[model samples]
Target chain A: AQSVTQLDSQVPVFEEAPVELRCNYSSSVSVYLFWYVQYPNQGLQLLLKYLSGSTLVKGINGFEAEFNKSQTSFHLRKPSVHISDTAEYFCAVSERDSSASKIIFGSGTRLSIRP
Target chain B: DAGVTQSPTHLIKTRGQQVTLRCSPKSGHDTVSWYQQALGQGPQFIFQYYEEEERQRGNFPDRFSGHQFPNYSSELNVNALLLGDSALYLCASSLGLAGGGEQYFGPGTRLTVT
Candidate 1:
């Protein structure tokens, strides 16, 4: 079984400011990590995923996440954010034994970009 | 690609009534997975269908059932719905890679159970 935890429920930041969204996971087997974004009245879109080979994975919209094996964390970060970044971000984890099926997602963090 | 497609973008149903949602997977994709997302919450997997069979299911009660057709399209049926059943129902499709494949998601069908 796998579980995902996103520490912050809401994060407010001024436009152009750097931000980080934290995520951690617990799984009995090897894991694949992912981040997804949901805009108002829209479905989820894949942000990025960490399968293997690289610890630091870059994704769309100038976002990146670092997978720390020991800390069991996969935190998303962006050097600078825009108002368009205001959306719900989710961190997810699936057992690597499976390709990415049955992934468990975090509760979500609502990122509000204040101008 | 057209990604995944779900029908009846928004629906309203009274409690105790049953509802059926439809989905069409992406081209060349044979697997469909369903999730329920409540307001302010992330999605929770409901089940997955492949090859016209229910391959996987979550902890949902027997009230939730699904079917996949030979054409690869699918439907989710919820019986005896409750107020909590009012949520966004999301459908995802994938290539059915063994283990875990990154499933592509559709915009979702918003169901409001009154």
Candidate 2:
């Protein structure tokens, strides 16, 4: 079984400031990593994914994440944030062997950007 | 280019009651998965349907069941619902096998059990 852990439950940042949301995972086998964002009353939207290849994965809305194998981390980062970036962020993982495997999600980190 | 979609954006039910939620996968999608998202929590996997069959399931009980039609649409049914079952029910869709591609999500059906 695979599991994900998001260290921060909430993070507050001012507009134009940089931010990072930490995520770690545990699995016996190789896995794929992903980051998603959920706006109030809406379903989740994929921010980026790390299937293979480059360690640095970029996504919409000026967000990017670095996959660190030794540290077992996929921390999401943004050089600058906007008020509209305020949303709940989730980190997820799934096994690489099977496409049918269920994706497990972390508790989530609520990002609040202040004007 | 429609994404995944679910019906009854919100629903209210009482404990012990049974409810059904529906979902329509994105165009060209053939797989659908259901998840439960409790307040202040991440969405938990329920089950996945492909080729009109359930290919994988999570730790949820048998009380939670689902079916996929020939058109690739799906329905989720819960029996003897408990207060704890009150949460947002999300339906996601993917092409081919679920693991190989990204899953597009629906707006979700908010189920409130009183």
Q: Which candidate leads the pack in lDDT?
A: 2
Candidate topping DockQ: 2
Query: Candidate 2, which segments miss by more than 4 Å at Cα?
Result: B98-100
Pick the TM-score winner: 2
Give the C-alpha miss distance for residue B37 in model 2, angstroms: 0.2
> What does candidate 1's lDDT look like per residue over A1-115, in tens digits?
8899999999999999999999999988898899999999999999999999889999999999999999999999999999999999999987777543776889999999999
lDDT minimum window of 10 residues, candidate 1 chain B = B94-103
True-structure RMSD for candidate 2: 0.8
Model 1, runs deviating above 4 Å: none
Query: Tens digits of per-residue lDDT for model 1 on B53-80?
Result: 7877788999999999998899999999
lDDT of candidate model 2 versus the reference: 0.95
Note each model's CA RMSD in angstroms: 1.2, 0.8
Per-residue alpha-carbon lDDT of candidate 2 for residues A29-82, written as tens digits (9 for 90 to 100): 999999999999999999999999999999999999999999999999999999
